[model samples]
Target chain A: MARRSILGLFSDPDTTANAMDALRGAGYKDWELDILSGAPYPEGTFGEHMPSHHLFKFPLIGAACGLAVAILLTAGTQLAYPVVTGGKPILAIPAMAIICYEGTMLGAILFTVFGIIFESRLPRPRVGIYDKRITEGYIGIVVTSDETRVVQAEKTLKMAGAIEIKSGA
Target chain B: MHNGHNGEALAASPEEVTQDILRKHREFTPRFKALVAVLAVLFLLGVVGFIIRLQDGFEHRVKWGYYAAVVVYLLTTAQAAPMVAIAPRLAKANWRRPVSRAAEMFGVVGLFNLLLFIPLLFLLPSTEGRRTIWFDGPSMSPHIWDTLAMVFLVLCGLAMLWAGSLPDMAAARDHSSGRRQGLFAKLAMGWRGTDLQWFLIRHRIGALASLYFMFLVFTHFLIASDFVLGLVPGWKDSIFPAFQALSALQSSIATMLVTMFVLRKWCGYERYIGLEQFWALSKLLLATSLLWFYFWWSGFIIFWYGRQPVEQNVISLIISGPYLPIFFTTFILNFIIPLVLLIWNAVRRSILGPTVVGCSILVGTFFDRIRLYVSAFSIEDVTAHALTVVPPAHTPDIADILIIIGALSGAGLSYALATKVFPVVNIWEIKEYMLLRVQAAFHRMEVTILAKPE
Candidate 1:
């Protein structure tokens, strides 16, 4: 059995959202539908569970790794080649703390960027079923389902005031 | 003027504001050129002055406090510019769209500061030999670590500025012609405003803003430690670093106010930059000013009550000694003037009133830096038992004055040049915010209701 993808373009977010709900009610799973728009609408506009993002613990992990490296670099280097300054101990806690802080932030920033790229799934092999008009203030509802449900999906989108519908593969 | 009681009357469409900003961006003006020329001359003068200082040996210029003070002051002012972009976003204030691009342009000033640091580090006394908080390793010195941190921060500032400017570059690319179109297209990196692109842009901006905020506190702490606390003998106040950071925020807000006034008057941005923005910023400035006083008082009270001879001597040197005039002036300008004027609702609501307060804070910050760094620089380690503060043996030589003048001009020049290259307003942000903010009747009055995504 082959799957067919349908894209419904609507002028308003409300219409697109309604179409998304009707398609889901017709036995389409949450993962089979996506709402795409030029502007970032509030999440869960289509009543789907919010997409999980890896950004949650990415920066924290980065910070931990950074802290370890910073300790090794600051404390380890000072201990390896000791040159005490101003009667202070060779390994000054305060001086090392500054290095540690900077390293942690640097790591967090690096990881946050990496997490964004990973979550966005950018630079894909190809953009699928995307309309140029979506960037010009159109709301696009993408639905992939069994070929038998194609007509039903089109009817649902039209009922919700979709301006245009395109189906492929 | 649109009066209250009707929600429909006050709502502005996103299309209208975008067109207005784009029209302003396309227009070429000669006024910016004249300002740039003036700043360039001042910058050149500062460079010549620096060269002269370099020619004079360290023995003649050992009172390097004055040099370091000028460098740090300029860097602090430059650093504050980014907060004008970051703070409003973190706070989620909608009025930030108009002037944020202009403020972000100042990130380029970090390059100048980085270059200026070369002299500061070269002339700085060695860490192992001096009684400071810096540590030494086989191949690495404290100054090396300091430079590395500074380089990292400057790069971060530049990256944030560039990332924020990309969407505007795309706008410019689509709505322009000839050489400018190609330039903008190249800068845009083929942004088509897809859902994923917008998501990534928004996410990156938030992450960068948060990092920058934390970095501000961290960088200021390092600065306060290296240049002020580390140099000053018997002057150990744990609150000084936080206090310095608070002062930077206060001065930065003031700088933004002044910049906003200039933009509104000269760039025909009066419609975009409204009194509401100034009113909000004035409140922030006032709050920071009060906190500035508290931090100063926190340190002052402890030192005053301790009655320790060393602490008392350092306090007297900073207050009633040669630095007295500067110290008192900073207190008045940084705290008293801003506090009194900004406290009045009438003054805080007006644009000119806040701009005046900003000017006072800027002047005060300059003097405050001098009082702290110069006083520390003048003292000598004559014996193992103690070091006493004295008047700086060396005054501002011709080079020092020129360097200070140059730094200011350089910052202004860089900002002006940046405006010509990029839209001085964040066009996309304004459009996006316009979508969220709708006028609605609240009880009897019509007010703008900014819907929260949460």
Candidate 2:
């Protein structure tokens, strides 16, 4: 058994739930931990209320910028070289509304996608873990505990349902 | 004393009963039969109108109506399909139990769009000597081959939809009974619920959906090429594909809404397509309608302000000309009317209000298509009173009408026939619903259990 156990990383709801239960049952709520998964797993599923994700909200902000840009683009074009087309109103609101709406949606989508990538910490500099089972179908459960409890926690999880148990050196 | 369901008084859970109804038996209520008859009739009428359209030669543009027909094509086929097709893909939920069939219906009806192209065939010299009072008209364009290819592609698109719908037809067929159905026996191709057949069918369904998305996009872009892409001034924007995509989505969802609403009361889908589902469909229509207005406006402003004199002529013609009423009606039907009706949550939640809005959108979108085509192709130089400016597009020539009518009749007839061969919805998927529900319930219990302190 390793001298210290720290379940700092991994993300699989099925396994995460098991490990969290194991830690809490063992009375170790203070252990540093994180999760990695292919998709967002509504952190509450792990028996903990996850920090709120504001990535989707960024679309709303992008929408605001979109509105400004649309107004500027439509009005500025007319202002820069006012098209006096048979003397009609140059700053057309009906037409401008379209511009604002489209631009805002576009901006919001771009930010939403980017926000997900940013929040995900995807495309890491190096491999976080080396296990083929994680990709195949196995949920990796990394448990990080203090020196005394590291071995105890590892034994408990491997007995519970860890296909392959590992620990920090 | 019989306190419980003893003779058949088993205390089976709700899931068991829901499963029994979904799996072993499903009856098409009188409401659905009536709806089916109504749909069939409406479809047949469209066919008849199409047949009537053929005789009057498409050799030359009618006084002002040719442009009107062309614009209708743009809105119906060009604008409506792309936006809604991607919705099920976007939501990525199994809850598509309610919407998938309607979405597929859009893909299927799109195939009939080629019938409208028959008018262009009237210009060919080959058809010149081929004059029957009702069936003969020279082709409308110089290239008969291109026209033929488009017509062919539209047919192929329809075939793909037919093949995909086989399983659903089989399900619907088996689910019906008595003289209550005549169409199913003829249409159903012995769907005896074999495991081997079900697996083969699923593989085919997946393949066709991918093909529909890929080919339909190409088919629609060709529309831009066939109509708008070639037109100058208004045609300059490269965003036309995006516009067409959004428009198709709007129309498809709007059409789906109308179908669902009609089906519920008329087909007894009150149990099937519920209020929650209808609301979902409306929300989709509303979103895309908003998207369309945005695209329409952006395209408008670009030319309205860019004003290189040539473009100004097109703009002035649309805004104030003899064409203003058509444009405004298009706006109201496509935008304002549906928008006002659907904006109130209470109204959209109502049974008929959403349906009316949906139908209005469908009709408006039709006018919108007419507006796009006629505005781009025909411009009235004279500024006359509202009534004096332009008349509705004249009916199609006899030959054009025949081919178009025959094609649509073929679709309705085929859809009726196709119903007998497959179930209307995914039968296997319906079975899976209970399992998912049970698992969900278990997962909830597990959470509660774990939450309790020792």
Candidate 3:
């Protein structure tokens, strides 16, 4: 059966780093250490990979929509309400330029907002879990190490000044 | 408070800092209070003027006065890149923090001006209602399209404003007092600031910014064409829209700087809008002033070379005409004052110098607009009717002066009101600063440790 271990979260970065060290030194190199966080920061700062956000698609998708909208609005307006002036064609390129420009920008802006929100995974469960200090610039590192290293890992973390290193399942 | 985040405690217990910030917020300064009082006076004056204009009925003077306000309104659409130009590169600020607020607030305030212009919309007298500022009296054929387009522009712009304001709105909602339930709450759409809400909120902001960029271009061109479409001699420069757009951007930057200066000086925001910001903004003012001069030179040079009678007459009259003093003053104020002051590192670093220079540039840009539009109108009306009237000989009629003051007051009131809540600088950016900088320092230490040889 997997043992459940509870780690007392520190609201401080040094303490947290120290705790991580303690866990590593206590033979819990592969032990599970979890950091309930407030802000989304990269684990890489403490020697781990930070997750990438889906916000990457925003600029590209938005730009495409903007362009398409610009063209459609410029053309659509000309066709919908053709006003020939001084024998000039109803769809004068110069006059319709304004609509195209505005429409494209509007599209991009609309999409940009959607993209950021989508990437954030907003409007869902926001349980008040661990380390509120994370919102205030604290870095929390939670790792599930292999069971063999738990004791040594806890000792190392303790030496490093970890406030708490609880053992668990 | 000056060293707001001097602790290396990694993550501070939130109670202390939050209490400290809240305490600081309560300690409102006299200078800002004084500014707010001044805004109130100006707003009252503007309201009186508006009432008087409505009662007196729209004549050439009153009508053009409204146009001047509209021109200022148009300018807000392209708030210059003062913060963005430097904040990220210089401060190494975080992506999800301080910058968004300024852009968001500016958008929201500009929307207020947009609503204020609704009176102008009603002022349009059907076939007779087509005002000559944004377009040549929304033509019957295009009026339908034009009106719908304008409605869309306004709707999209307003929606963007609300969307962009969401996160801030949530922050404000949670932080706000019982009495402090202001516009944000009314417009917040039940934004609980949840993680789920963040997705829609962030998406809305992104969409707004993209649309804002496009809207600025449209607003720029649309306003210029409206005024110049009458083929008013020197006023008929095709580059007028682009020039107006750039000048609007410059003025907006100057305005933002001035706003920051006041916010820092009065609200005790020592860390938020810092000396570094002053330095960066001063440099921007220097660069933008040069750009302003470049546009002015190109436009004048082309006219001088082409030697068109109408254009030259319009040009020479301003350079050496009875209005020469205002003309030269505009140039000196806009270009020279900022350029010379900004050259020095210290001058840029100093708060007073840049604020003064920025205010000066703002004045100069406005004067330039007046000289270009209002003064030109005086000449055009004279030439068209084959009559002469000396504009400088008479003081500005109460109505003319009031409109300008009223418009400025509108901007001022909005700014003063905004700083009361949102930290002028992004709180998150500062947090980023505290974190990344610490990491970078430790990273360097690691390099040293790795590099050491026994």
Model 3 Cα lDDT, one tens digit per residue, A1-169: 3444344546575666556555555545332554443332334334322334555467567767877876776667668766675587766766655555555555655566566546545433332223333343344444454454444455555566656554445
- The docking quality of candidate 1, as DockQ, is 0.28
- Model 3 Cα RMSD, Å? 7.5
- Considering every candidate listed, which one attains the maximal DockQ? 1
Question: Which regions of candidate 2 deviate over 4 angstroms?
Answer: A1-169, B1-55, B63-86, B89-91, B106-108, B123-207, B229-235, B317-319, B341-344, B347-353, B376-422, B439-454
| Interface RMSD over true interface Cα atoms for each candidate | 3.7, 18.8, 7.2
Give lDDT: candidate 2, residue A98: 37
DockQ for each model: 0.28, 0.02, 0.14
Which ranges of candidate 1 are over 4 A from the true structure? A1-11, A15-38, A46-51, A78-95, A113-169, B1-10, B57-64, B135-140, B306-309, B379-385, B442-444
Task: State the lDDT at B23 in candidate 2.
Answer: 43
lDDT of 2 at B431: 35
- Candidate 1 residue B427 Cα shift, in angstroms, is 2.5
Residue-wise lDDT of candidate 3 within B1-454, one digit each (tens)? Answer: 2222222222343333333443454456687688889998997787777776677654444255334534454354324332242233333333324333554455445545654555544432333333233232234423343344445455555455455554444444445567554543554444442223333343444445445555665665665554333324324566666777777667766776776676566665554455555666677678878888888787777767877676666565445566577789988998888888888888887878888987897778766666655544443252242123334422356866776687678766875676555434444333434444332345435211111111
Docking class of 1: acceptable
Model 1 TM-score (2 dp): 0.85
Q: Candidate 3 chain B TM?
A: 0.76
All candidates: TM-score: 0.85, 0.53, 0.71
Candidate 2 at residue B33, lDDT? Answer: 63
